[model samples]
Target: MVQKPTLAAVTHQPLARWIAYLNAVITFKTPQGMRLTNQDLTHQGHTVRATICHVGPEPADGTMLYLHGGAFMIGDLRMYRHLVARLGQAARQRAYFLHYDRAPEYPFPAALDQATTAYLALCTDPAAGPISLVGDSAGGNLVFALLHRICTRDLPRPAAVAAMSPVVDLRMRAKSLTTNRRTDHLVPTSWARRGCTAYMGSADPMNPEVSPVLGQFDGAPPCLIQADETEMLADDSRAMAAALQAQGVQVDLQMSKGLIHVWHLNVGRSPEADASVAEIGRFLRGVTSRETV
Candidate 1:
């Protein structure tokens, strides 16, 4: 594995500070032509809130369920409003972004349950078409685990999945975890390990649901993973891709250099971010392989 040289990327603000800032950032109106609805859904007795964003004319067929990344701590539907809006735009459909529970208060199966219920709800919705699951960082972990669980528990799997800089391996044992430690501005090695420990509670770190690297995935949905050359979880995506392919899952992997984890949030400031989004848009187009809405 060739390590890319690190860049002085901008450090993400602390969770609280960033959340406060986000509250004031989107006050300005969005594109008038686009319409996005925001709300919540009841899943397994949990009121999992979600923001529904629409991109095209109206009545979108397929839907992509989005899970935001926050190291299993911060981040929610409101925090990722802009990104969800873009996903709606990218797919020319509506996106339902899940605001699942975070760690400490509600960890492990809590988010998993929310994801499962969300998918089930979508499958029942009238507008449902070929569905997809998308997530970043810990959310990526949920996406992978969701697929495995859906298969194991006989739930419906999505048409495909696209994960960006996902932390599939919660044990923090990926080779890139050590090699890219100094390069990734999004996650420090200590922080990654610490987050894993907190999220796991008493559960085993390698429990496929807790950390998907150990999970069995056969006949899994087609998967596309995007990672950065410098992110600690670069190997997380790589290892999952190799495993998914070995199991005969259609897989597409792209690694962008000198970027941090889930750099898609940098869509406005960094060319790398836009490039990642473009590739994602292309990947979605290919996976769906259907006509426009």
Candidate 2:
């Protein structure tokens, strides 16, 4: 079925536009929310940021080290507040947003290193137990890297990993890259390439650190990849799933229709967003519930 692109599909809400505009306007921000009050046990020296959004009733079972989407060039924790808050509600726990380094400044390993350090710190916190990782857009790329790095070092793997419209393959060779090129209103191929250039800084786009879809997920935990049918990166999930499944890894791949890019970013408004979050919530719940926890 051919889906028509709309403001909803593209996340063209006035709020989104304003946020994008603000991101473009400001290079650095204090982030409007409760600042990092303390991180002694969980994150010793790591700079782990958080925005408390209505603490749930259940015990703090686990933490979702969430990374935001901006093609790795622009965007911060605030841009994902709406979706991350709802994700916390979905998981019935707290979600910590990572204020990682951006592109054109600290490229490649810098951001990945910070995220890995933060993850290691979080794992140390018993309060932040049963940790899981998730991200959207370029953040998804980080999640892929986190999984691979953890596997390589023979460290503790997260319970599960989830990504939305992840640019897993920085080379952008996914079939959907060309298949849905004209339909994905929010992010065009040209814009994506521009951001990729800024983040990689002359590094090969296909480098596993840059494009995780081509990397290893064999020893990693359960993984899920979600993408919008109208987004050119839908094939990112397709390719990642095939690779993981080939290695006998548990993977849940969902190609949502009637949305652009990471529909889950729209959370409250887009039905597609709700569905995507719900799916991830279910995956997390299943993992934490069925297993030791």
TM-score of each: 0.86, 0.84
- For every model shown, the clashing-pair count is 0, 0
lDDT of each: 0.73, 0.72
**Model 1, residue 256: displacement in angstroms?**
1.2
Which ten-residue region of model 1 has the weakest summed lDDT?
A: 1-10
Model 1 stretches with alpha carbons more than 4 Å out: 1-35, 43-47, 56-61, 290-293
lDDT of 2 by residue, 1-293 (tens): 22222222433334544656565344222223323322322344656444444333543547787877787766655566667767776876567777787776788887888788888887777777688888988889898888888887888888878888888888766787787878887776766776677788878876787887777766888888888778877778788788778878899888877686777766666676777788898888777665454
Q: State how far residue 228 of model 1 sits from its true place (Å).
A: 1.0
Alpha-carbon RMSD, each predicted model:
4.9, 5.7
Backbone clash pairs for candidate 1 read none
Question: Which residue pairs show backbone clashes in model 2?
Answer: none
